[model samples]
Target chain A: MAEAQNDLKYLPLNDLHVELGGKMVPFAGYSMPVQYPMGVMKEHLHCRAQAGLFDVSHMGQVILRGCAYAELAEALEGIIPQDVVGLAEGRQRYGFFTEAEGGILDDLMFANRGDHIFMVVNAACKAEDLAHMRAMLPGIEVVEITDRALLALQGPQAEAVLAALMPATADMNFMDVAVMDWDGAELWISRSGYTGEDGFEISVPVAVAEAFARALLADARVAPIGLGARDSLRLEGGLCLYGHDIDTSTTPVEAGLAWAIQKVRRSGGAREGGFPGAVHILEQMTNGAPRKRVGLRPEGRAPMREGVELFASAEGGELIGHITSGGFGPTVEAPLAMGYVPAEMAAPGTVVYGELRGKRVAVTVTKLPFTPANFKR
Target chain B: MKYTEDHEWLSLDGDIVTVGITEHAATALGDVVFVELPEVGTMVSKGDEVAVIESVKAASDISAPLDGEIVEVNEAIVDAPSKVNEDPLGEAWFIKIKIDDVGAVNDYMDEDAYNDHIG
Candidate 1:
């Protein structure tokens, strides 16, 4: 843990990770656990079959408080591609901060609690995100929660385990939010996660973070998970990692995120544009982009990783595109990958070749979610 | 018995010494998630990384303790890498080799020497 510890600040549960016998590592600029005593494989299977608790305190938690929540929403809608203004109270939605050229800045999670919006951004991009938010929405009070700890309880059994601690949490549906009292401290729980399973991302004050973590882990079904299984689990779900899938070079349309940009934002009808990349985003929405992000399922046991070249199998391996994300899916029991190919070659069942270690391996452009996602409805 | 500072234990039988990662090395690598072993007949040189073993966070290369021709491999390690962590000395032996010199085993560190070398 000494060599793995980062100079960056740690969450309240940092000691707990050490107690759980985690092999800590530096990830996204934070010292986090890569695996626990059960190891990566066992932890991965546990998340799928049962529930796993993750300490994700490094992510940015912004509390937007002001009288003009609608005004703030409209302003946020300008920079991101999501239908934020149309979001109802107590609901969560996914969207991204776009670069001025329509490139994705970062993918983020937003929960609209009517009076204020509690937003969560990736750990790596928290600083840049805060600066971006401040630059775009002047006078809108946004407080970065540095003294808080975030935890994710994921998998099918996650609900039952969390329900035991916070009984009211059981009634919360998917992509919903609830302001609950956890041992007296306020906790913001979102019914969402990245592992393609039913789970909740909880934000608790640093003072009560450890107690909350232990309380949930008291249930037999819940186990403390690390970052290794977390990566494999999300990869199997076909979810895009911030740096890998959606980056500053990719646009919402190019990343297959056009659906996130509501029609109202594009048309400038009701709660019209104001965010950073709105102008370019609306243009992309009106006129289809040149290339869009699509999923790829390579036919072979070999895993296709990011930056692996993709080519047409017919033209003696003519260069088509490259893979962005890929891995061996434990659930699907096969290797899968995703990448941006030529629009014509992006269809599912389209035969493609992925060059790995210089050999062009056969691949198929198949539907995403190689494994069926059991997200709670 | 000779061993590399990397904690590989080599046992010499004639001009051959069985090579395997130490328990310390296996535990440090965490779970034995994936392994890429060299061909059985490939000629390996001293200090050449002939095998790739990956855990969740790090990947380790098993070096040839001394120059030798690979004679046999422990396929059970490939079947279940966790054995490397559980029984590194017994069932998780990586590969056996016909060494270039029977005396090379004397050059490697013994159990006490390796224990101190790691410290």
Candidate 2:
């Protein structure tokens, strides 16, 4: 298949995906591989049991630089909800860009790389995210690295596969960032991943992207994964996919992401932080968080797919919520989903019913991270 | 032994025509993650929905090539859907239908013609 191009752009590995017999689809503007030769189910399972590689170069990688690390952090907190002011050097935090009405702009990962905040965010939301940052942190500079390719080597053998190429990187723990020199490329390597597995996300220049991808695949242990598998893999891991799970309309609290808010940031008049939705967010944090997010395990052979209606109480069940992401989890060997219900029914062990084809299917409210997370913390 | 233009193969010795997805079709479908079987003794018409086959992308309905009644089903694909991806023409038969008119098999394209059409 020829590489597809639109107003956005294509990754350097886009041609490689086509050459590898991948079914490419347009996602977030760039033509992306949705499934490859092994297909989505096998790829999903393979990533769970072994290892799979993903070309996530479409996501915008940015660098924030201006002043001291502390000053830069403070500048960043002007827009985002995380207490960037308290972020230690060389440490990373998961955070959100919030709107005034307590809605999330986008969920992202931020790393304090000593001098600047090195961050990666969803491809679909990158434009707005970068603009939001530039507008909010006027002193700090934001650079969009479009000439780069991001690949995620995710699963149990992630570190091992990466270790073959970068010896010291393999030793890095989760959320740690190390800029290592590989083949004349100053690639940034992070022991981080979306799948609840041990993995590394590498940022290589477009020129080296395909070669690096080929090098990784040369190891019989690594397989080329596509977007379809990526979705299922993250879903099985109980991680949220940006558009499907959270968007500008959803709040971090309602999305069950209150844990990411630093306790100090929530303290009233603490450092007088200027962040979006800080007031409402602190209120939600101080008082109990309403409408917690929970994992749902449906009891049956049929899948309680996304957009399916959820109900509270078993008999004469009242419609209360809807599934955001749902699928048959090959790893868990059952139908699974992530969605929201009333705060009361969001607790683990709560019994609820999902209406599929007008019949109420039995489901049990379960804790998030339904599958045990294997991140190398 | 016969094939349909849509790439379904059937071999009939009597009223029962052993059926399975064609190799070409299976290869295109990639890995089959789920296979739904029609109940035995259920009446089926030519071009009627006989079963459901789900790959990683989405579930698709498998239609019958000839009018018949389902006499047996290959439940094996339900347990191991990848069997279709590996050996679609041999072991991944969704169902065997008792043909209402054995002559209807003639309506289906032959292997040579089916291959030509598929190609």
Candidate 3:
């Protein structure tokens, strides 16, 4: 199809996606490719079995400078629950922008790049996140890096492919960040990705992005993957999408993201009760959340999509919860979903029914990450 | 064989009309993961939703082209929905209906006309 309406922004790889026969669609206020000629199934499977390249330039990348890294980390901790002050140089941590009432503003990844902190936020939440950072920490500069294009090279062969060009990437552990120079072009490469695979997210200047993407695609191990496969891969990996699985109305504890909060940010720790939602979030951590996010596996073939209600039984069961994200898991070879239900019914083997097309289809509650995460530690 | 605007193809044999989705529809849908067919003996009017087909990315409704009673449903395709993608017009036929009015089949487009319409 033709690119979305003129109002939508285009990614740097838009033309290349079209040239590769990608089906373009409107996503997060941008015209993007949902899948290429191989379709989402093949693209998702390719990432699990081999390697896949993703154009994630739509995600917001920003640099926090004009202050010491330690001071910025403490200032940032006031909004997020993570122990940012303890983050080592060249290491990254995943956390969320939490509201005063304990609701998540947005999930983000921030790396302590020594001189400055490098942050990446979801595309849909970038504008507001940047504004929040600017308003919350007045003196520190939160500079949006719009001149860079981010690409994710993920899967079993991702390191091998990147090692061919930058041998230093092979030595880096998961969540390591390094600024490397290749052919005189500066690149910031992070050993992390949304997919549950060993990978790297490379931030290259827009001027050399096209050539860099082409060079990566030239590698036999890497195939161009689109947003469709990216969603499926993250879903199977049990990662939450910003708007669907986790949102402004959901808290980290309720969303089952309590693990992201290190001990330093919790009750009785050195830096406890300092973040925006510390009071309520720590309460939930000490006690328990009313609802918990859990994975759902359909017993049959019908794919349960977002907004499908969940029931406790197959015959006139009590309403339990609603599915937030659901689709066929290409790797699991079955339909999988994630949603929030009463904490009592959040066990892995709990039998629940998903209402599909006016019928109750049986499903089972399971632990997150339908597929085992293969992140290289 | 004839085709409807909705991309369903019908092959008439005596009073029973066999129905399946066209190749163009299958290609657009990518992979077929599930098929929910109407029960046999159910009466359906033209344009009524007679079946539901799901792919990894989306779910689609298969509509009836003519008023008819469902005489037979494709159990094999329901058991293994990939057949709809493998052979949409052959072994993947959805249902056979005893059409209420046989002359209604003439209203559908022939092969050449259907190809032109899609283009």
Candidate 4:
């Protein structure tokens, strides 16, 4: 165990997390805090009620720079299905790298940062994503940002807590990105987060990362949250976790992420279908995918977690689908799950059964985002 | 009180042995979200999985410690699973089984031994 722990990388705030009573565990090759002394349930509720601070430095941060913004965006359009060229400067959009087949390589958030394109991919898929981008975009510089640590301050009081430190934050709207000065350091701040709440994701220099985190936690409303609550928060928000919810085998259309695909990239539009797997992906968009991701609310309390098979009836039927991500939703105050099912059975009121411990439990197909998002439009 | 390596604590009174998970086990499990206990009068062999405990992170099962018939099951923890984390050794006692051989309790670890095992 000691030898294995040695192989895991530590975050910039590892000591701080340990001092705060965080239960450190191995995740994505990093020793990250899964929960703190307040536990997962309270941490999840705290994020929804007030504000929670998260250390998300393990995620990959990269800068794709070319001769100009247009060239960089055009080159990126060849890899992803999002409207990169049309993205306004100082704005971010949710997108994914697609494979030759119609499956997602990795879901990512990219911003048009005026001079260059900044992208953040999932931690586990960082190496592959970096390699893929470097291989695909020949002239573009796919530089990974290794000198910064990322932190997300999420919830209703997030803006208030952050704006207290930097007044300019109050003026930014959701998906808006800005390089603001804080304590003599340039902070890459974005009014965006995974939790279904108004928040900010700041990329701070590694030197001042801990200080910035401590400053935020000094607020009574801002508590230190860990990955456990982070998972439940995103799950409740209907956001996808890369490997679990959406993977190399799942397409953006089948994962219910069609909204992220702009019309400019879709069929019958200018700059239509230049990305990888454009033919199959466009076909799926024009017609429909065989299966689709949907929200599920299991009857009673037992959560139908990942790998639990779904059936058409309580007694027996061929396995229709399996849970991708699921757990007790603290904010929703019930057990909720997200999984892929046949498109015909993906309607909001459809009833499916998930086999739990050999017995089939009734699960109703519900709408995504078990809780309403409170974004600052 | 006797404890098993599995972290379950058993207290014997006459022929009925009251069972509950140790506080150490509860702490390790984090916050308990749901618990499904066995029904009363169910015959269970030693090491048979009898109860299910679901926490925020994952799920675990409690096994029958001895050959016995479940006499009573705690409904409180079932209604409020958080009680398992709050009072794991008190009100969160899972079941009371009427075992045929009361001497079986002597084979398990005592309080001090269980503490050393966890240590």
- Can you write out model 2's per-residue Cα lDDT over A121-212, one digit (the tens) per residue? 98889999988888888877899878888999999988788888888986788888888988898888888888888888899988888888
Docking class of 3: medium
lDDT for A80 in candidate 1 is 78
| A126: Cα error in model 1, Å | 1.2
Model 3 Cα lDDT, one tens digit per residue, A131-239:
9999998899999999999999999999999999889999999999999997779999999999999999999998889888888899988999988889889999999
Q: Candidate 4: TM-score?
A: 0.99
**lDDT by residue for model 4 over A1-377, one digit each (tens)?**
88988899999999999999999999999999999999999999999999999999999999999669999999999999999999999999999999889799999999999889998899999999999999999999999999999999999999999999999999999999999999999999999999989999999999999999999999999999999999999999999999998988999889999899999999998999989988889999999999999999999999889999999999967999999999999988789999999999999999999999999999999998999999999
TM-scores for chain A over all candidates: 0.94, 0.95, 0.98, 0.99
DockQ values of all predictions: 0.35, 0.42, 0.74, 0.86
Docking class of 1: acceptable
Poorly placed runs, candidate 4 (over 4 Å):
A1-3
The predicted structure with the larger DockQ, 1 or 3, is: 3
Model 3, A135: alpha-carbon shift in Å? 0.5
**Clashing pairs in model 1, backbone N/Cα/C closer than 3 A:** A78-A275, A79-A275, A79-A276, B2-B108, B3-B108, B3-B109
B1-119: candidate 1 lDDT, tens digit per residue: 55688878877777778888888888777766556678899998887888877664455688888787998988787766668888888778888888877776787777788888888
Give lDDT: candidate 1, residue B36: 65
lDDT of 3 at A37: 88
Cα deviation of A239 in candidate 2 (Å)?
0.5
User: Model 3: residues >4 Å from true position, as ranges?
Assistant: A1-4
Instruction: Write candidate 1's Cα lDDT for A147-242 as tens digits.
Output: 888999999999899888889999999999989997789999999998999999999998988888889888889999998888888877878888
Clashing pairs in 4: none
Docking quality (DockQ) of candidate 2: 0.42
